[model samples]
Target: MDNNSILLIDPTFDPASASTCNLLVKVGLDSFSYAIINKETKQVNAVFDEQECDNGAQKFAERLKTDSYLKLPYQEVKFAIHTANTIAIPNDLYNEANLESHSQFFTESHSGNLYCQAQNHFGFTTIFTLLRAIDKTLEEFTYAKKYEQNAGLIQLAEKLDGYNLLLDFTVASFNVLFIKNQQVVFQQCYEIENTEEFNYYILLIINQLNINLQETALNLTGIINKGDEKYHCLLKYFSKADFISVDTDLNQEVLDDMPAHYYSSLLALNQCV
Candidate 1:
């Protein structure tokens, strides 16, 4: 049974190219998505979204070896794995022994199953965690937070004038990244029911940062467009609201047809440190 409820795949995928392809995988709370990117052309040849299973992520971790949807040499595969863990510690204040202590405040599980990752920025160091259930996949694949990769793309936009707010969205959840002075100030994920709740969070972020909507530029990505109510609400408050385009030199012919901003996080996985 090769069927795993794939939501999408590229039409031109060549099975012979799997060895050289670089895969980007994200296992979320209730869904999993992956993009198969070509090494030479730097374009996605296939992308897949699968239905939630009892242990969906773990299944994906193991199924990559023999999943019916695609075929490849599991022993020599190259990939990047993404997670949304909220645990992070600053370098100046980080302690190896204290990681479990600090992380416990954010997540219920800080046991051996919890795997940690650290990223260092100029001002502070970020130490985050992942799951050990997927360790074998990380033996060669890069493990990263969707927030970090999404934030990197936003910072790369480099419009750091007052405050830059970048939002990446899914069905009922979203990740918000705040960039200032060419550096990341804060980034967080929230699940909101409606536009009002989303607006409330935006207001708090702006007020906390002491930003002037007249000056701050709010650029958006992921699952939102010009006509969407969420987009209009943002437009109403921030005079300079704009939809962020995927900033890359990837295959233009292949990506021109896709909504670049919507897949910014998936496409920018290679940018994570």
Candidate 2:
């Protein structure tokens, strides 16, 4: 395994049984990860993660061509691509006929395809864009379902109650979702190059949301570790900061040597549907 990659496979996993498994893939700005889980038992069979990817879509396409595990036919294939070109509009104000115009108001200049997903419980619709290359790569799989990174976060946040701030981090980017009283209040993705930039965003969020750091529970997951600079930065203000544990039936032995929180957001993709 490469220094920047993580590979965990259950000894009992059978490639032939992949037809009964659901494949979940998360393509981040600088990372790529996938997990296989049995549909009925909800047991994770395998997980592979590669970080600091350059030209992520191309790299993923290459892996699909060569990686035996990825070539297996699964019962369902779901993709969650990370993108900053996304906007949420109130359902009452959302106009499907004007999707292009509505998306143009928020998304940056891009020649990608536009798509929309309704968050009925939240009373809004999310309009997002996916790179054409990424879309083309996904075509390799039959009837593959596509979604943005926020979809998984929303699914996980729906289960929580009261003041909660969820943070999903990557090597250079992070996704933030703030839920209060079982309702989503704010959510956005940010790219940071250093600890200072990360701290700036945290402080900005606190001021804008009027968040009581001492009272609000800060639940974190993804490429962050305890005692790291970023983690330490968060502890400075939020007294209730801690890593989130995903609620799922997984093969514990496969993850025995790794931190389960590292795959929280990725594993949450199973709850997207």
Error of 2 at 4 (Å): 0.5
lDDT (tens digit, per residue) of candidate 1 on 1-273 = 235445455678777777666666655444456667777777667666554444446767766676644455321232333355555566667777756566655544544334444455434444445566665555544433324333344444554455677787755557777767656677776667788898888788778888777656787766677778788777767876676765667663445555667666666664544
Give per-residue CA lDDT, model 2, range 1-273, as digits (tens). Answer: 789888899998999998999899988877888999988777888889898787556668878887899888899888888776888888889999988878776657777778787777777888888877787887778587778877777777777888999999888889999988877789988888999999999999999999987769898888899889999999889875778877766655667788878888888888776
Task: Give the clashing residue pairs of candidate 2, or none.
Answer: none
Give Cα distance to truth, residue 37, candidate 2, Å: 0.4
Candidate 2: where is the Cα deviation over 4 Å? none
Clashes of 2: 0
How do all models score by TM-score?
Answer: 0.74, 0.92
Model 1 weakest lDDT span, ten residues long: 73-82
Residue pairs in clash, model 1:
none
Candidate 2's TM-score reads 0.92
Each prediction's total of clashing residue pairs, residues at least 3 apart in sequence or on different chains, is 0, 0
